[model samples]
Target chain A: MESDLVTADMVEATEFPHLSMRYQVRAVPRTIVNETGAIEGGLPEHMFVDQVVAAASQS
Target chain B: MALLQGRDRQRVQSELASLANPVKLINFTQELACEYCRDTEQIARELGELSDKLQVEVYNFQIDKEQVARYRIDKIPALVVEGEKDYGVRFYGIPMGYEFMSLLGAIKDAGARATGLAAKTKAALATLVKPVHLQVYVTPT
Candidate 1:
């Protein structure tokens, strides 16, 4: 079974209060969608950095 | 305007105090305007106590323009992990909640100058020598 990690309440509780106002809180499956409307999962740290570096280099 | 309420401030302070390593927070709002600027400031301040466990550095984009361009960061409140070499790990939004773990992991990897992937995972990752780009955007929920 897929473990239920990081619940909605947990996310709300950890957010810095003032910043929370800018985001829309929805209870749907909790998907992370990018500006391009693509859903993504939690990426590993190294891979994420590599991506950013690649993007920066392309600019 | 204060981004953190008194209660949250106390909680952050206490958490920082308990950490073994200090972490540095670089704030980008000063250059790139964003709504969460104030909140990022508060986070940087609260993370001060963790200095012993991790070295935390706060940089405002207004002052650190060179670094920002180098990292190709076009957003406010991005975090970069500084290690043996700039690993280029960045968090575009305030790294709280599940993201916090990612942030901490980045810091740990940076500090150790190593990625703690399993042998099999590392072997697989080695094949990706060409390069890969990934961007993930999410709301606080």
Candidate 2:
């Protein structure tokens, strides 16, 4: 919502059962960055941004 | 059929009343073979009804290749929330339950074209050199 380099998508796990399984979504609010790094649960805005930046930098 | 009713409608209307600018909800769906497309479109329409500042546009994913590619929609029942500019905020499935709050929040943010992020966070994001894609998985409940 802020950066041009970032895009955010919210997926309803129940509606898309296949996506839930594919991403191994066993919890609510599991944020997957770049389809690789997974951040489970909600974090404070500051922490969440840090986690997302770190996740995006993952190899 | 009305998706929002009674207190919910009043509450949503109240929230939308404070919108600083106009927002557009671009809904991508197909006529057939899509289970939730109808409900998704209806939800967008209902939300559109809540605020004149918000507009809803429907496109057939199976037929509207140009729009599909323009929005980079890769799935059905998708809703793209855009303000004056495309902020790249998208919902891959129906935004019900907890996600509904997120949808409303997105509308407000997009309406203002501002994320309301703190300066620290904004500065952190400014350091990003590569594209980042975030997919948050949640349930309606």
TM-score of chain B of 1: 0.71
Q: Tell me the tens digit of each residue's lDDT in model 2 across A1-59.
A: 77999998888888788888988999988998998899999899899999988988883
Worst 10 residues of 1 chain A by lDDT: A1-10
| lDDT by residue for model 1 (B40-90), tens | 556655554444655556666777778778766666666665554455456
Residue-level lDDT tens digits of model 2 in B29-109: 888888889989999999999999999999999889999999999998999999988888899888888888999999999
The CAPRI class of candidate 2 is: high
| Candidate 2 global lDDT | 0.90
Which DockQ values do the candidates obtain, in the order shown? 0.08, 0.88
- After superposition, the stretches of candidate 2 with alpha carbons farther than 4 Å from their true spots are none
Interface RMSD of each: 11.6, 0.8
If scored against the real structure, what TM-score would every candidate get? 0.57, 0.96
